[model samples]
Target: MGDVGSVGLGSLGHPLLGAVVSLASGGGVLLSGRLSLATHEWLADHAVHGVMLLPGTAFVELVVRAGDQVGCGRVEELVIEAPLIVPEKGGVHLQVEVGEADASGFREVSVYSREEADGDGAAWVRHAHGVLGSAVPSSETQYDFGVWPPVGAELVDVSGEYVRAAENGLEYGPVFQGLRRAWRRDGEVFAEVGLPEGERERAGQFGLHPALFDAALHALGVSGALAGGSGSLLPFSWRGFALEAVGATSLRVRLASVGAGSDAVSVLVGDESGRGVASVESLVLRPVDADQLNAVGGAARDGLFRVEWVDAPGAVAAGGEVASRTEVVRVVSEGPDVVGEVYGRVLEVLERVRAWVADEDLAGERLVVVTRGAVDAGDGVEDMAGAAVWGLVRSAQSENPGRLVLVDTDDVEGVGGVLPGVLALGEEQVVVRSGVVRVPRLGRVRVSGEVSGGFGSGAVLVTGGTGVLGGVVSRHLVVRHGVSRLVLLSRRGAEAEGAAELRAELEGAGAEVVIAACDAADGEALAGVLSGLPEGFALSGVVHAAGVLDDGLLTSLTRERVEPVLRAKVDAAWNLHELTAGMDLSAFVLFSSATGVLGGAGQSNYAAANVFLDGLASWRRAQGCRVCRWRGVCGPRPVA
Candidate 1:
């Protein structure tokens, strides 16, 4: 061994790794590279909840490549510790450390990275740790994808796999969409995965491109194995993995369950001509929820979004009023600042929508619901009660599509100049500020670092505190956010399934847990529970997580079916807001849903209920009240 700097670095022919060097120390090696969304654009395609991540397969590729550099062609074992997050800007400096080989010819290997902007002195976070073994034995099972699609295998539909993946927040862009075709045969699945011509041309730079390898796993989904119909699954651990060849542009894969009733699968990989490329004896995949990914992403998770008012040019009508087909219904605040009046006002707007849509004479006309300062509009809200109407109507707009529009104004007199023009433009939502017509658009919140939590040292109230979602939120608040006291409110309360266990768990974590039988939707019941807070514990926060689901298409839905869902959310939220309005609370959190933000086909009622929470949050924030709303994570639907 000579001076470390005197050792020349060598290439592993891997696109992700810059160079590999034989350490001056006995049998050691170091692999270095840099990763960024700009350079590795394909990484951006594999985003979970808007946070781009280096696919697990890429780590496998890096491990295999580093192993090959040291005459160790097999990845004996590998475990992913944390996600390798690629931020929106800047790159991460990566290092693959392969330790000195042992007497049995096995070596320790690990992958670590740090933000390039953090400079060299910054702490390096290890993403993966594994072991490398001697060269793969040549006598291993060989596969030549000779017959193509395999004889007697039934073709599996892969067209909608990516679509379904997107619905679960596993958004795969074109580069990562490599599942070309798949087949099933006698409890085993086979697939042919290939990269696009552009990506294929770059395949020579790596052992096997991650996109191609990941697509091979998509075949399991077609056969109801592993991550079938539950949630997105990511590779957690690998055992006895071996790679014989490099630069595979396309892969022919065979996946079989490790044993009966087992979620682990054994994978065999080969080239199109049937030459062995890689093999995994047992690969265990674990379910990954958005929260886990969001924690890794930190503030990078779906960056904050605000309603931006972009100028809606050409939205002025000729002489202020010209469209005869457009009808405007102005909704004024029901009364002077009342806590529960917003729910009644929203109900009135809902009925008006029902009547307008049901009327044959008005079938061709677009009903625009206008309000004064109902939306923040880059300013504060003046009409809090009228704000709930926006949420109700957005659902109506979703269910009725093209039949309704929403408009909010700061000044009634100023709106007259742009109202007709804005209506003529047929935008779904519009805001008129000082007579300047503008439409709302969503822009990503530029995040710099971690956003601090506002949890205080007082009892936090969770309305639906015993449901599946409520339980998850309660535990999360205690474990992650450090809320020391909680008042769990539900109709069944302690009688609710797992309520006792959940209370015990929270209490064990040093939290004061109060489980009370109270219907959050019932104002008197909620009031009783809130007023009965334990001695020495004052209210510090409110989390309205209570809701019931009565999912049905718009045609099959009725006001009766919708009201229960609304009572649990809309009514409960109103009760909580009113009861806690004067209290100096630190956090007023609302559990909403993506369906509310973006309507679901069979969840109009649920969507309406959750959207009301969204509107309520905005309204509360406008009133100098501390409020935070999560539109998807803690809703009726499983957090994506």
Candidate 2:
């Protein structure tokens, strides 16, 4: 063998090096010889962290060559008789039996630098592998490759690129290993990174870890040019769609940008092949410099918040998409008692106005009551005789004519004390504390509002009646809870299949299944659908499950994944809420997931998208809307 580190013939080097060299695995014989020397020296220096040597001809040669230098009689015995030997002084080392080595070829190898020897580092590596393995296509074949550094080696330098290069080439580099590799793709991005096959099998099932998802988002910032050269950070929203469960071996991701201007959206799709998968969409805000972030106390201000338009017009007639601005305001509550008192006053006014409208409209000639403190004072009322109260009455005037009445009382004893006498003669009346009015009589009146704090029927209009999850939830509702009617809302251009499916599933369930396909996401379309509902219909529930899951990681995910999913989940939810905000409903079941709670490794981009669902749930609940955060888990069957 050549001198340790020097490639040549007839050169003497360390015995350990010679043994490493003698076996020609790849490259030139001389090159192999030199590498053997370098490997042995590297292992011996500072004691290797985790290195396992399998029993074979090469191993035997190494032992024979070590001879007297084997140190410790115990080491010699381990080399000679034991099926496996661990170098006690160095990192843990296991010498596998020759038979075992022969049965399975080397899979992949993970060489960790000395610095990554701690438990946290190990955990990170393991998590990364889970993300990578889960994304592999289901059709790939299995192979065994060597994993270097073994289990005890302290990783001095751990790189995703290095691992990929060792496995195959630069093209095969795993994206999740580090930030560098993840930022390469354009329009969309994806990566497959993880522990070798054997290692993955050893680790068991892994959930999507938040670190990995965050890293993917970081990579997206770099790839999409969202991150400025000065390293400023931007705020964004993410919506994720869960497709399947992910497990060990490989991971895949796709990414892309959707929308534009100050509020841009990025989308990411991730998969674990035949296992669990998901799609995520992130709404990114304008970049903020470090100084600005610091001034805000490391927290983003509310004004910069973007309110995703719910059922807002998509792509205005001018060709640009419509966006909504969101502002966060902080209100200091004096106390619960004060709050209650304020609300009570407001309700009392509203009730009085309603009563007045009902009493005036009894003759039923489209009576409009404009009120100013329980007296009609506004000129907006066309018919003064038909109006119950008159004279520019700002306080008693209804906000909407023929539909509302307002009665304001300065003191508790001013207008019938706490119970003001407001009458409605004909039209439906809504009363307000400051003012009230009779609302216009539309052909159909749809009641959509939110309900909280109880187990009751919640109404949700499903536009795509035939969709999978939509059908599932609807069936469950009617069969499990005896729901009276399931108004299956769809677009005017919806396919006939949807109506057929709804009829087939709900025919005899006593639930009136109305199939109307108008873009549920469109405010006008939704309004029309609501107007068409039968009289006396009261919605008790709403389930927004209409969505799609596109597969791809951060780099490879595209607008195809980002926009539709966002429109379906975030935007759709908002629109549905707007259409039903005034109606009575008990629960709003938002299908969220553990992916949002825990981010996926290679699926960093996708996981970020799903997190927005959690934010939505919190926001709705704060508004007194009963929101359910559904976290889906997987596995074998077990008795409930």
Candidate 3:
């Protein structure tokens, strides 16, 4: 990065990163390359929620590579736009475009990717963008250390940090485990993370080595643990982030609390010379799990929700450690009564999260709504509303990686103790009862065991029957399950485009099919439909297969996006629950998805809605009511 007055586009010859196509200088450079699992298979190891994605660090590597060609010596700032999902077959075409230097002699850099299309043309999408500048500090803002290991600083043991991180799916190899020494001075953290002798010499080749850079963040973990941070923490965004030097074997990292009102920390990195090497105005960490990262494509199930439940022998979470950097808010009160009130509180809490994430970045944080007198209360409004929370937060967690730690506890002291481990574990939820932290797991127990003889002329009500999955189910019920009488309920029942075709298909299977257009979310309308069922066609089986997908990342989601999804899943389920409770139905099957059991990214609101159904099923079972659980998946045709 020092005076590279003229380094033309020579062959990159990087074995893993691929070759650079060109590097022309207009005080900057533009290069193109082809990437694939064949060339960068190691990258597949870096995944979130079981998805093989391009890591955020890879973007930083591009900026460093760009700075090495230009005279610029550092990456001033970088912001990730969208994630790049590596394809299973074809390669991804990449472009690194650097613009001419600006007023302050800083060049803008961008990284773009377009997956090899199977049919239609695919446009280039920018994944990450940032700025590159000179290595010298524009203004020297000196920081006084006074002396090494300042007085009153607590010496924290960071020896086993990486191993624990690996257990939680971080899997930082030896190359990235850069913590050498650390100390907690007052509320500020001071640490040194040095690279191994083997990696130091190569540091001069690039503006900054990702290994060294990543290691520097180890202090943040220790600092977070000291301050009450738990679980796996991922960097969500960078603010005024800048690198001041080209090569540094070790960094003196200093992190101090921003203020009492915020969970952020101001980060300052210095070299052995005591000069600034890098500075981050503020940094935020979010709680994450394996399931939150991998919902893209069809490979979301099977491996996504791989959970391990650990039973603690002690009452309190050992030492009850938490990351000083993480934002943990404890909702100590018994929550509101109505579902509307709960949702209002949800929006209010989300607003606070939005502010913490601020700008375009997804916030990395945690919320613990601990209630003491709710459990075993037999489906009270407070408990039911709280059950809805598990779904809502789990869905949000999927969209925003490492962003939540949900804990329900009756024990008051267990609150602080379980946080560190829960935050560290990144499991969607854990309940602290009987002096143990119980991590929950989603398992598929076959609800339909050998469909015992047909419906025996009893009429079956199928909600969302006009939809693709519903039509298929209706036909299946008639042909295979011996269901002779069918009542299909959909918002656009007979008026839907494919409604007649579906009815014909079901009727062809030798069953009497009745179509009704009803909004299941409206209890009154639903009750009216149930009461007016054709005489002699008694409602025996109820299959609630209704749902809608209005997708958005948690960062972009709001009440507008969440309500429609909830009405179909949560509210509609509630209506069905109330209306059908008195009836002696053979099956009360609720059509659920992997997202409901395993929260998927971009379906935060949907996930929450589906989870409510699951909770309702359990609640009904506890009340001695018969509730059936049947799940099926259906794919759609390509949009014209």
Candidate 4:
């Protein structure tokens, strides 16, 4: 050890010092000869355990004179500079040698008692021995995480990479055990989980479960060390693009962080290829934290603010006092005076503007519309300004009363320079277009559309209708497709409180809705529901949206875990095809996931399930059924 080490151990008891000194000042004659009463008592108190005395012939000559006192020269040298000693022929020698007479009588020895014999006692001997003998447990066990299957088992080939990554070893048993089954290729990691093809009749194509998507995100974070970076949900917005509708047996994700600023963005891409399948760009507004990453919409939860400018020249109107008191004479020269016709035109324009205002649904919000013009008295400037102001007020009030602030251009000129035909509103917030915001709460979708001429009244059977996505699809079918009635089916009947609320929401949206609580996964239940529809009513279409996620490694996953998800999605799709056989239908839309194309880590089960749906959709399409499969890795984004 150097300076730092010496300082660190200065107060620590060193065993070597005691052993060395004990060999030197041990005998009664030597102790009496070398030490004074006070020094002897000090030596007893310090308890010197061992020491060494060297003879000149041996290795301790070459420096000291023959009569030089050992107490002063040798003893002091041994204590303060023993580390400088070096080994020599036949023995160890001090760097300096004493005279020949002194060296002959000198003896080298070591002394110890029972307590000091072992140097430091063996407190950790058992543990050290065990460590040497046994295999080391994995580092992953430091945390309370597990893998899907027990170690040393054959893995199953599910759908995509994500399911394999998550389920392969991380969730089934001990973490170390699970890691063994996973493999790393390039910069990405993959895992293989099992799928029981023997259960084919009951199973459907695998889809990417939300959990699998989330876990894949987690894996990306872990792989890139982005978990501790300055961006939260950094991968959500950027990487999703390339992964849009990919479904594969394995999912590969790549992450990159670039740019610098308060609003720096992190880009992540997921794909099975070395190139990305889906890319996400996330705008980080603040320093990343665990809470932000865990949040559904990343940092956008604060709400998105926007600025919109509307130019209105003839939309505002003057107050009643101006309109009532002001009167002007019009020169007339023909059957219809030009002044009268102009006044009529002005009135018609004002009415149209007012109607447009009244029809807007601002939800009590107000907006500001500014007009600019140089008015001449003969040009009806006062009336024109009044009409414009009135239009602005009416439009704002109708949209969302008080939400839009109406400002006159005349007022803005004093505070800032204004350009012709230019109006600026401070900031406005708009609704999220699609994804999670549009869906609202979990398991529901907010759907709005206009009803137009279409097929006559009939019930729409929406598989997974009780679920969030299904419910929204059902609402859209009823309101937009002109379906007079709806029959919603879920794995469980719609008797729960959530089902009731869904019913109310649909009813409020102007839909004649009926709830059917049946296991969409159960073909028999779905068939029975189809049979029980009101007699003579035609079927409009079916939307299959219900699905599940079973994430884990192929080696750790069990049959029970992976089968239900596939069965629910794929089986329900096929069952619906059978039940609606030969019936008049409009469109059959199947929901698939991007994971089926882009394998996801730790989501082999889910990817397998979604892949099943993709194949089933193609099969249905070939069978001459009007089927379209909407495949994508859907997350917090709104649906457009």
Q: Highest lDDT, which number? A: 1
Better of 2 and 3 by lDDT: 3
Clashes of 4: 124
- Candidate ranking under lDDT, highest first, comes to 1, 3, 4, 2
Where model 4 places Cα greater than 4 Å from the true spot, the runs are 1-457, 631-640
Please list the residue runs of candidate 3 whose C-alpha ends up more than 4 Å from where it truly belongs after superposition.
1-326, 330-338, 359-382, 412-414, 421-428, 440-457, 630-640
> TM-scores across all candidates?
0.55, 0.28, 0.46, 0.29
* Error of model 4, residue 506, in angstroms: 1.4
What are the per-residue Cα lDDT tens digits for candidate 1 across 412-449? 65565676677678788888777677887777764322
lDDT scores in order: 0.75, 0.34, 0.64, 0.35
Per-residue alpha-carbon lDDT of model 4 for 105-149, expressed as tens digits? Answer: 442211111111213331111000000001122121111113322
lDDT of 2 at 449: 11
The count of residue-pair clashes in candidate 3 stands at 19
Per-model root-mean-square deviation over C-alphas: 13.8, 25.3, 27.0, 34.3
Candidate 1 overall Cα lDDT vs. reference? 0.75
Off by over 4 Å in 2: 1-460, 490-498, 601-609, 631-640
If the candidates were sorted by their TM-score against the true structure, best first, what order would they fall in? 1, 3, 4, 2
If both were scored by TM-score, which would come out higher, candidate 1 or candidate 2?
Answer: 1
